[model samples]
Target: MPHQSTAPPTRFHRSIFARTVLWAIIIAAAITACLWLLTDATIRNTNQIALERAVDLDLAGMVDIHASGGREELARRIADRIALQPRDGQLAHYLLADTAGRRLAGDLRQWPGLHAGVSESGPIALPGGSAFARATQLGPDLRLLVAHEDHDIDALRRQVALVYVTGGLLATLAVALIGMTAAHRLRTRIERINAAFRHPDEEALARLEKGSLDRDEIDELTRHSSEALARLGRLAGAQRETTDQLAHEMRTPLMHLDNRLVKALAAAPEAETAARIADARLEIRHIVRMLESLLDIAASQARRGDRHGLAPVDLSALALRLGELYADSAEESGHTLKLAIAPDVMVEGEEMQLTRLITNLLDNAFKFVPVGGTVELRLAPGPSLTVCDDGPGVPLADREKIFDKFARGSEPGTQDGAGLGLALCRAIAERHQLEITLLPSTRGACFKVAPQARR
Candidate 1:
């Protein structure tokens, strides 16, 4: 099938770090508001208590002055106290009133309308700004009012507000920093774990070293992944050994059989007998080729994610050279070969393996194209390679299946192939971290081989 690329859907809350930071900010704001309200209420209560205590002290002083020296002495004492306080920044006001609610003497101009006992009065217009008065009854016919300027309490409130605001901002910043740091660490660890899974070899496992005993979720994951990779390595090793032993055991007998068939054909005198011997030898040779192809597939699969043998290869040059080498064969088969390759298109891969991969693609294209049809090999930027032929395109139903070993296209009987060509191509592409897929074309087949990044 023509490969189709689908992008993963995006979600807003995908990042754990972002979610954590958002929640942290919300919680911090709530806590900050609650603390501010509590602190504000406590400070207001304390201020009120201090103001009331001062009023009570003033009332007591006025009563003592009145009892000791009568109204004349009481008025004189009040005037003296008022005079002692600074006029420009007076915080306290005192009012002495008689039975008829007339101000006797004090800084206050009139008797405040209040019930008997201590009562608070707000923002009463004063010379500077505003004042709050605390009134108390000193006698059956006498009343005393004490007022303090509101600026002092307002200043105190402002200071407390500043502290609350500063604290709230610092707390929010600290929370954000902590959340970001934690998120970064988590993402890094997750990426490392993903890499280990992609390359499940001893080196990848060794890199996922055992963490501390008091392990977190990430550490535990690493531990488990290491164990899994180790197990996978053992299994792969066993499979490779088995493949090697089977190849050896099978190829030895096949070699002996081929030798016996050759000797039989040489000894046969009759033309019919010699023809039968030749047919058997051809079948044996086909089996031997199948075995070799199978071994190549196994080796390619085993080398996936292993870069030890990789080196820089000029893919453009390789494609052009192969096209030239196969030109004579194409002409012999009554097909035209064309090359449109750009120079200096380098890639990191095994040169021998990459050559085989390209060769297989070109061979398959040539095999399917009819006489007088054109097979073109093109190399372009992104280090992409393509082999296109004006042949019957891959059927939609068989496109995906054609990459499987022993899978044939719709016109299978028209072509002579073991059908492992595309499968081997896929194996080689995977080993080099490349992508190979059939591209949709209107009248022909176009197979693309390119780096994964390009895909």
Candidate 2:
């Protein structure tokens, strides 16, 4: 089996880009909220100050008329003038009160509960309706109250509301524009970084030959990617050269060794020579198997494609064949092997590879099972194949690791061949996008292979 390379697991971590964007949004929200509050407070303050000024000017005019001994005459004239302004659906309530809060000549029924020296203010609601009011001391014993209904104040309120809404919308739009620009720039930079991580292969070679760098983040990324790829390219090139050299140098020698062993065994004159020939043959098979597994891994990796000659292969027949093949050996070892194939079970995949996968699984089951134990081969329409054996079940800790190349639970130097069987099976199953699982069973290992189409 070929050596497998796997990476260690790491804790989940947030990216720098995510953190930057999150902080940007938080700051934008805070600034917008502060601006809204300030704008709202200023509008209210300005309206109250203007209203106070208007009320004071009106009060001064009334005082001038009273001083000229035109109190009754001016009151009639001012009342007529005030009545001339439209009062329909308008809150206009006037109150003339003494220092002791006694009503005089106005439509208001009573004085409002306001603290002295409190003047500048906007609208407030009373039992009668809504009004904006201002009040002042007219003399030592008289007070003047002037107020207008909230119709004009309502219009002003609407205007202020509209301003705040428009301001908020504009702020949001500006934030969106700024965020998009920053994100675009950041994305461009990161793309270049990512291009650096990819392997240098044929496509990368073509890109290098293009000899063009736009000189942005993407370019930096491409340059870094090229450097990493170059390193991997050199390593892969060296490895390929070594493999080719080994195959060229060893194939003939191995064949010669096998030929010599066979010939010497045929004319052996002693038990010692026969035993030596047997050992040589066994060693030669082991070397050949190792080389073959390597060649398979390399060829699969290089092709970058799956075999395309797919057809519906009857899984039931395959299971029956395996059951019959292993039944004799299983019986010889005082164990029982059985086939429980459902009729017309079919799957779509490479027939040869699937057969080998099943064969390897059965071989493992047989090797692991104790005498008088039972091994069952099940083939069904829905899922395809399940190989179970009443042997020592694989421990939970070893289940995942056993699928790795050259990994086995058996003691070293005892198993007959390299532990490539399960790894090869897994590779073939994955190429077809099928799921293979080791199901918990009663006292043994149970493996199930389910094809995508069947599932």
Candidate 3:
């Protein structure tokens, strides 16, 4: 009754939507990181090269000016640089000093101690930022130093990194949205195929058989599966038809033979001869019962999972009515029929078939248990019915085997039965989408009918 969930149901965490989001995030992060690394490396190298060139040219020009016109001319050029770009002075260092270490007309607090004589170049700290610098001992008297600040380059790198971050976020969002849409459509298509099998009908089957002209693996699978189902349906229909025809053909003659036996019993000259004829008639009756039971099993099997003719049946009331009807029989057999029935336990099924299912279970219990034994029938909220008998319980070996058609229990008293009762009970339960199981019992055989979900 409780069928398995969808094939795609359990692994939802690994679905297309989830995988797409994960991969999108990974790709976006990788790209953004690579760009940031490249920007930092390239800008660092360019900053170093730039600082070297600017300082080299400034020192060269100062050397020529100081050699030709001494400290007067060199100091004038440094002063012109400071006056033209005051902000530039924050990044571009300038200094000119005499042998006494007294500053000339340039923007420097004091002449810095340059370690590498002649031409010095390396990283140096300045107020508010860091920089790369080059210093020179010009003409052994007037010193000139030049440096370039890196705060502007650091700000530029951060701006580029921000742009990359925004782009990665947008990429992740866009891929996530696209993945959801694709997963929805793909999941819907898969569910459509599952629905056809769950509640198969002419239209759904036909649709599957026709399939899509689209070039996809799922569509191809549907087409192949539909063909298989069609084949199986044809085979099952033929088998049922042939079996029904044989059952029908054999029924009339079996009835006529029984009627003839009855007539012969009436006309027999001696009590012995009449007794023999009566026994024959009894055997004939058993055969007829077996035949009818087989037909019922076959009918129920054919009707399995078909919801067309079903309606809500009050199973509680039905059990109550059957219990009352069997009370007389139970008393005659010196057995107590105890019913612990709940109210309004409804089920979806044919009343006649459900009645037969319960009837067969009751008959099996009554047959197995000896006189003076107790038989209990329970009805509960799950529309669950259980019939248990205080008889020699079914052997463990035959428990599962006994449900098969024509499977007889190996216990001593089981021979008289045609072994169709439990088989028919199983078929009827399945037809109503319920499961009947041989529950574990301490003292007797107990059979329970309920939906699979409860189990």
Candidate 4:
């Protein structure tokens, strides 16, 4: 035979940290892109404004000098003055031209073919090669032109470059810090998981669960794991109890069958046959009841969420109807059954589930009450239902246990049930977000189911 798989079963398992980090990196990239767009727009606008102002200032001085008719002398002086200024030649290299398109005192071999005012003129080949020119008309026939170097706006380029570099560096730094913090917390959580996985033993789990490490995605996983362990512990205890109960329940019938067989063997033949048949019928009924109880438990668990849809239910009317249905049975059993339903009581729930919940409580009351005992069903405007019986009430210690699957307050030898009625009742009530509790009673079991107001 092929080897069977030994891997543990799991529901959707994956790393939460990986998902969180991936999302963080994506968000950081988006922020960086947005910063680049805004910075680029601002820088370009500032550079254009500054370049226009520089041209205007230089043009004003040139126009004043040319209008005075100080042609050759003024051009020479202007060039000399430009050379002496701090950022004069540094801002732009000049190429001055006279009115008849003649080269003047600046660097150009000829006029740049424009009587200009802050306009683009480019690809003007000189001894060096092609270049870009920013020219402005200075006089009737004289033009003053400024051309940037062939290296292509290096200074302004550097400023934009620096902005991006700084922005990228900052983005990288932030991402690194976030990634480091995430990884550190992730490592701690993985360590805890490893420790818990290796020892699954309580002490290790307790240390991991109780110790407040750091708050991150890992903390969520650790908390979930802790909760899962607690649930598993409860499930294990319940399983043990169920196993013990099943064994005990099966043994009783088997023992009775054995005694019946022995008794039949020693009796007269005619009576012996009848005695054996009766014993057989009893054993069959016991087995059938056990099977029916098991089916009910399975059905209840399967139908847990089938009643989730909202429906308006009149609680008081339903209680009154159930009270009437059980009245005759209660009288025949020599127990007094009474109903006290408040007017206009309503709730939002599945009518069938609510009905079943009430029926189970009344069933338990009827089972426990002795002859001439009283069972009362009460409903009030408080939107609560209470059932009380005049029988031995449940002990304080067994209150919670009585609602557990296959649990009963009394010993199995005395009770005639599979011990699932109260558990089913609790499940049905809880599904509707109703609170059911064992209330204090004078001499009998009293229980209440209180539902919250619906919005």
TM-score of each: 0.74, 0.66, 0.77, 0.45
Instruction: Kindly report the root-mean-square deviation of model 4 from the true structure over all alpha carbons.
Output: 16.1
**Global lDDT scores for all candidate models:** 0.80, 0.67, 0.79, 0.69
Q: lDDT for model 2, on a 0 to 1 scale?
A: 0.67
lDDT pick, better of 2 and 4: 4
Each candidate: RMSD to true structure? 5.9, 7.4, 4.5, 16.1
Cα-lDDT of candidate 3: 0.79
Estimate candidate 4's alpha-carbon lDDT, on a 0 to 1 scale. Answer: 0.69
Model 3, total clashes: 0
Q: Give per-residue lDDT, candidate 2, residue 159.
A: 82
Q: In model 4, what lDDT does residue 439 have?
A: 84
Off by over 4 Å in 1: 1-41, 56-78, 94-120, 123-129, 135-145, 150-224, 302-309, 331-334, 342-344, 412-415, 451-455
Q: Tens-digit lDDT track for model 3 on 1-455? A: 32233233626575765576667767877877787789789987887787778778876887788889888887888777677775743666677766666877576777566643557677776666666767777766656777666557768788877887788778767776787677777777676677677556677788776665557998887877777767767887798889888887888888899898878776765888888888888888888889989888988998787664677788889999999988889998899999999987878779999899889999999988998999999998876799999999999989879899889988676887788989999999989878899999999999999886534
- What is the C-alpha lDDT profile of model 2 across 1-455, one tens digit per residue? 11111112222244555456556766776777777678667867777676666666765666676678554654564566568766666445566667788876566767776542455445556666766777766567776677765346657666866776677667766776787677667754554344333323465445653433766655665565666667776876787788788886887799888998898888954998788779889999888877766665453343222333446677678778877888888888898988888976666556786777788888888888777888899887775578898777887667878877787775443356687778777776775556578887667899998854533
TM-score of 2: 0.66
Error of 1 at 322 (Å): 2.6
lDDT of model 1 at position 434: 82
In terms of lDDT, the poorest run of 10 residues in model 4 is 1-10
Please identify model 4 stretches exceeding 4 Å from their true place. Answer: 1-16, 78-100, 116-156, 159-170, 183-209, 212-243, 246-250, 266-455
Model 2, stretches more than 4 Å misplaced?
1-38, 89-93, 97-103, 114-128, 159-215, 230-234, 266-272, 294-357, 368-373, 377-386, 392-415, 418-442, 447-455
Ranking by TM-score: 3, 1, 2, 4
